[model samples]
Target: MIRTATPDDVPLIHAMVRDLAEYEKALDEARATEEQLREALFGERPAAFGHIAQDDDSGEVVGFALWFLNFSTWRGVHGIYLEDLYVRPEARGGGHGKALLRELARICVERGYERLEWSVLDWNEPSINFYKSLGALPQDEWTVYRLTDGALAGLGAAVE
Candidate 1:
């Protein structure tokens, strides 16, 4: 079963995030703290939302999807931007991942959102295959760019 995450789920979600980063071979970059997640997910005027997937028989949380709303000027509608989706290794192939995504899709349909989107690492063929199986297409023509750390600070300074 999938449900909205509550304050109690914050620690579990943060641990899963670290596990996911370790799996992706980027453990060093997984720097978010539980406090940050709590503030972002459950604070007043929350900036993001999360959904938890639990094991049917054992009632243990097996996966989670963290997402936020994004507006599309062309569609004049809000869409979901999935920041991260992670299922425990022991829980993979048990439909947990699909269930998490299905919940997100349901939310999109209910809200008249134009799209549900997330990025997968290019080298992660298993995830790519799974997404393709779900009818998700690759936006191969576009390149994603980011400005962070010193660059972001420098840019902010210039704007002052």
Candidate 2:
């Protein structure tokens, strides 16, 4: 079963995020704290939303997806930018990942969103193949860029 996450699920969400980072070989980079997640997910103006996938029989949350809305100026529509989607190692091959994605797709269709998108590490062939199997196309022509940490701080200081 899959359902929208609530504030009470912040701890689980944080743990799952760490698990995902570990799987991606970047555990040290998972620096988000539970308080940050709570504020971001359930603050006065939420910055993102989350979904949890549970095992019906065991009633345990085995996976989760965290996403936020983004505007596509060219398309003149909104889209969902999935930041993380993960299923526990023991829960693989159980359709949980696909179910979470399908739920996101359904939300897009219901809300008239233009697209649902996320980035995957190039080395993760298994996830790439899974996404392809769902008919998701890769935007290979576009390059992703980042401006964070010191660079981000530098830009803010320059403006000041």
Model 2 regions more than 4 Å off: none
Against the true structure, whose lDDT is highest?
1
Residue-wise C-alpha lDDT for candidate 1, range 36-134, written one tens digit per residue:
999999998899999999999999999999999999999999999999999998999999999999999999999899899999999999999999999
> All candidates' lDDT scores?
0.96, 0.95
For model 2 the local lDDT of residue 132 reads 99
lDDT of 1 at 86: 95
Model 1: ten consecutive residues of lowest lDDT: 151-160
TM-score of each: 0.97, 0.96
Deviating ranges (above 4 Å) for candidate 1: none
Question: Which pairs, if any, clash in model 1?
Answer: none
lDDT of candidate 2 over 2-30, digit per residue (tens): 99999999999999999999999999888
